[model samples]
Target: MNEDEILARIRDIFQDNFGIEPSKVTPEAHLYEDLDLDSIDAVDLAIKLQEMTGRRIKPEEFKTVRTVGDVIGAVESLLAA
Candidate 1:
């Protein structure tokens, strides 16, 4: 899928799983600082993304995911793979 589609899915995941407002989930939004997500929340996000993509996410692949844009890029790469 495209980046916009991946972003939409990320927004949905953030909203449904983390109770975050969709409007707050933007490309530049930091997962921890902006979204107030903790490390456990990061793990939860990874699990949720795995469920959505039906693919296992490597820890290394997610290591650099700090922003919503990074998450979108990761999901896009996973989907493409």
Candidate 2:
């Protein structure tokens, strides 16, 4: 899928799992500072992303994700792989 589609799926994941509004899930939004996601929330997000992509999320890769755009990039790379 393309970046927009990946972003949409991530938006849905954020909305469904964290009660975050779709409008708030922008590319520049910081996963922790902007979205109020803690480590546990990050783990939850990774899980949801894994479920969506049907692929296991590597901890090292996930460790580098800090923003919504980063997550989208990670998903894109994961899907491509």
Candidate 3:
């Protein structure tokens, strides 16, 4: 899938899993500070991303993620590989 598609999917995941409104999920939106996701929520998101991509999401891979765009980029990279 393309970047836009990946972003759209992540947007959906945010809404479905976190109860975040669609309008709140933007490229610059921070997962923790902005989206109110705690560490546990971050783990849940990683698992969901793994499920979506059918790939293992390394804990290290998620360490650098902070924004909604970060998740999209990571998932896109894995999908590309």
Clashing pairs in 2: none
Off by more than 4 A, model 1: none
Say which candidate scores most in TM-score: 2
Estimate the overall C-alpha local distance difference test score of candidate 3: 0.91
What lDDT tens digits, residue by residue, belong to model 3 across residues 1-81? Answer: 987888888889989988999889999999999999999999999999999999999899899999988998999888878
lDDT of 1 by residue, 14-75 (tens): 99999999999999999999999999999999999999999999998898999999998888
The RMSD of every model to the true structure, in order and in angstroms, is 0.7, 0.6, 0.8
Query: Model 3: number of clashes?
Result: 0
Output the lDDT of residue 52, model 3. Answer: 93
The TM-score values for the models, in the order shown, are: 0.95, 0.96, 0.95
Ranking by lDDT: 2, 1, 3
lDDT of 2 at 18: 95
State the C-alpha lDDT per candidate: 0.93, 0.94, 0.91
Overall local distance difference test of candidate 2: 0.94
Displacement of the residue 63 alpha carbon in candidate 3, Å:
0.6
* Displacement of the residue 37 alpha carbon in candidate 3, Å: 0.4
